[model samples]
Target chain A: MAYLILKDLLLQRNMMLLAFAYVLLFAFAFQSMGDEGQLVAIISMVGYMFVMVGGAWEEKNNSDTLWNSMPAPKWKIVGAKYLAIPVYVAFVTLVYAVVSSAISLLQIPITTAPINVFVAALGTIGVFVAASLYYPVYFAFGYTKSRYWHFILIFGIVALSSMLPNLFPEKPAWIDPLFEKLPKLTGDAMFLVVAICFVALLVAVSFLLSLRFYGRREF
Target chain B: MESILELRNVVKNFTGFKINGISFSLEPGYIMGFIGANGSGKTTTIKLIMNLLHLEMGEIKVFGLDSRQHEQQIKQRIGFVYDDNHFYEELTITQMTKVLAPFYKKWDWNTYNRYIHRFGLPSNKKIKTFSRGMKMKYALAVALSHKAELLIMDEPTSGLDPIVRSEILDILSEVILDERCSVLFSSHITSDLDRIADYVTLIHNGTILFSTSKEELFEKYSLVKGERSLLGENLRPYLVGYRESQFGFEGLVTDKAAVQAMLNGNALLERPTLEDIMLYCTRGRAV
Candidate 1:
C-alpha cells in the first residue's frame, strides 16, 4: 500500500512546481473569500489536482494491466488512492505555509491565509469528503469513464460556492432553526470530534464501495 | 507432475470476438509457445490467465490453485511481461522498481541490479527515453528479479530486432535451466519459437488448433514440393494446404509417409517449420 502511494507521488513530482503556481493564483483569485476561504480553496484545488492527475497518469500509462497482473490486491490499489488524499492535503498546506511566510517576509501586497490547525483540519476533511465522492466512481469505471462525474463535482462545488449567496438573497426560514441550536449542540472541540467521526464514517463507507466497484472492473 | 499453468475450458466473450472454451496446460520446466495471428485472442487468453479480464465461464489454475481464489498467492510466484511497457514512463527504472519491488514476496535487488547491469540499461534515464528494445529488457529484468517460478510473456519479442530477440530468448533459456521454472510465451514470430519452444499450442480464431510437443508437430507435417501434374485427386487428402505455380506445386501434408508413397519418389518431402505449420493450418488454402 505504501508502495502504491509512493508511485502516485513520484508520478506527481513535477506537479509540486505547478502547485506553487496554483497557491499564488488562488491566493489572489479568492482574495474576496478572505484568508480562511483562500486557504480552503488552495488546499481543495491543489489536493484534488493531485488526485485527478494520479488517475490521469494511470489511464495514460494503461497501468491497470500492470497492477492487476501483479500480486497487489484490488483493495490495496483502491485504498491507496483514498489514503493519499491526506498526504496531498498536507503537501498543499505546506506549500501554502511557505508561500504565506514568503509574503510576510517580502512584504508582498497579496493577502493569503495564515495556516492554523483548525482550518487545516477543516481543509483536510473537506478534501477527504470530495475524494470519498469521487473514488467509487473512479474505481468502478476507471479514469476515462468516470471523468464526466469529476467535472460535475468540480463544477457543482464551484457553482455552489460562488453563486449560492446571490441565488438566495435571504436565508430560508428552515435554516434558522438549525443555526439557532448549533451553539448549544456543539462547542469547537465537540464539533471537531463530530466532524472527525462523520468523515471517518463517510470514508469507511466510501472505501467499501470502491473496493466492490474495483473488484468488478476488468482491465 | 503438476502443470505449471492450466486453463480448463476458459471462455470470455465480447461483442465480436470470443475465446470459445479454450483449454491447454504447460508442464513445469518447459517453454510453451502460444502462436496465433493478430486478433486471434492471444492477448485475451493471456489476460484471462492474469485475471485482467474476468472469465465468463470456466477455470484458470496457476500452480494447481484457482487463479481467482488464490490470485495473490499465485501471482507472487508469477512474473509477467506484456507487449507494451506498462510502467510509468515518466520515471526512471530505478524509481519504477522502487514502486514495484515491494509487491513480491521474494524480490531480490541484487538479481535486479545484475540484470540491469547485464542488459546495459541506464538507471537514471526515464523509461520514455529508452528505445523499444531497452524498454523490453528493463521489463524482462524486473520480471526475472522476483525469483518467479512461472513467467507469462505476451508478445515480448514481437517488434524487437533479431539481436535483442535472441538475447531475450537466451535469458529465457537460462531461466528454465533450474527445472523449477516454466514459461508461456505468446508470439506471432514462429522462428523465435522454433529455436526454443518445447511445446507449441497454435490458436486460430480463438480456438486452439493443436497443442503438442515440437518434435511431434514437426514429424506430423511435411512440406512437399513437386510437379503441378503430380497433384492428383488421390493426393488431395494428403495436403493440408497447397499452392500451384507455373513451374511446380508446394503443400503441407500431415502424413509424410503416405504422401511419399503416393508420389513414389516424384515429390520432395521436407520437415515443416513452425511457421509453415501455422500458415497451412490457419490459411487452409494457399494463394
Candidate 2:
C-alpha cells in the first residue's frame, strides 16, 4: 500500500509542485476575502483536484491495468487510492499554513488565523465528503467514462443550490427552522461528533462499493 | 510431471467474440506457444490467467491454486509482459524499476541491472524516448529480475526487427534452461515459437484447434504441393486446406501416409512448418 502511494506521488511530483504554486497564488488573490475559512476551502479544493489528476495520469498511461497485474489484492489497491486523498489534503493544509504565516510576517494585511483547528476540521471534512462521493463513481466507471457523470454531479449541485432559493419565494418550512438553529448547532460538540460519524459512515460505504465495482471490472 | 499452469473449460465473452471452453496445460521447464490469428482471443486468455480480465466461466489454476482465490500469490510467482509497454512513459528506467521492484518479494537488483546493461538500455533515460524493441527488452528485464517461476508473455515480439526478435527468442531460450521455470508465450510470429517452443497450442476463432507436443503437430500435418491437374475430387476429401494457383495446388493434409499413397508420384509431400499449419488451419478450407 505504501509503495502504491509512493508510485502515484513520484509520477505526479511535478503536478504537486504546480498545485502548490497555484495555491500560493490563489491565497494572495483571495486575501481580500479576509476569511481564513474561505482560503482553507480553496486549498481543500486544490487538494481534491490532485485526486482527479492522479486518476487521469493512471488512465493516460494505462497503469491501472499494470497495477491490476501486480501482486496486491484489488481491495488494497482501491484502498490505497482513497488513503492517498487524506495525505494530499494534509500536505496542502501544511503548505497553506506556512504560506499564510509567511505573508503575515511580511506585514501584509492578510486576515490569517494561526492554523485554526475548527477551520482545518471543516476543510478536511469537506474534502473527505467530496472525495467520498467522487471516488466510488470514478472506480465504478473509470476516469474516461465517468467524466460526464462528474460534470453532471457538479452541475446538479450548483443548479439545485441556485434554484432552491427561487423555488420557495417564502422560506421553506424545514429551511427556516434549520437556519434558525444553525448558529447554535455550529458550536455544539454533540453536533460535531455526529457530523464526523456521518462522514465516516459515508466513506466506509463508498469504499465498499468501490471495492465491489473494481473487483469485477475487466481491465 | 507437475503442471505449472492449467486452464480447464475456461470461457469468456465480449460483444461479438467468445473464448469457448478453451483448455490447455503447461508443465515445469517447458515453453508453450499460444498461436492465433488477429482477434483470436490470445490476449484475452492471457489476461484471464493474469486476472487482468474477469473470466465469465470455468477455472484457471496456477501451481494447483485457484487463480481467483490465490490471485496475489499466483501473480507474485508469475511475470507478465504485454505487447505494448504498460509502464509510465514519462519515468526513466531507474524510476520505473524503483516503482515496480517493491511489489515483487524476490526482486533481484543485480539481475535487473545485468539485463539493463546487456540490452544497452540507459538507466536514466525516459521510457518515451526508447524504441519499441528497447521497451520490450526493459519489460523482459523486469520480468526476469523478479525470479518468477512462470513467464506469461503476450505477443512480446509483435513489432520488432528480425534481429531484435531473434535476440528476444534467444533470451527466452536461456530462461527455459532453468528447470524450475516455464513459459506461456503468445505470438502471431510462429517462427519465433518454432525456434523455442516445446508445446504448441493453436487457437482459431476462440476455439482450440490443437494443443500437443510441437513435434507431434509437425508429424500429424504435412504440406503437399502438386500440379493443378493432379488434385482430383477424390484427393480433395483428404486435404484440410488447399489453395490452387496457375501452376499447382498446395494444401495441408492431416493424414500424411494416406495422402502420399493417394497422390503417389504426382506431387511433393513435406513436413509442415508452424507458419504453414497456422495459416492453413485458420485461413484455408477444411475437409
DockQ of each: 0.91, 0.75
Cα lDDT tens digits for candidate 1, A134-215: 9999989989988999999989988998898898889888898987876655556777788889999999999999999889
Best by TM-score: 1
TM-score of chain B of 2: 0.97
- Residue-level lDDT tens digits of model 1 in B112-185: 99999999999999999999999999999999999999999999998899999999999999999999999999
Write down the RMSD of candidate 2 (Cα, Å): 2.6
- Give me the runs in candidate 1 sitting further than 4 Å from their true place: A166-168, A176-183
lDDT of 2 by residue, B1-287 (tens): 76899999999988899999999999999999999988998999999999888888999999999999998888889988899889999889998888889889999999999999999999888999999999999999999999999999999999999999999999999998978889999999998999999999999989998999999998899999989887888787778898888888889988889888888878899988899999988886732
Candidate 1 to truth, TM: 0.97
Q: How accurate is candidate 2 locally (lDDT)?
A: 0.86
Error of 1 at A115 (Å): 1.1
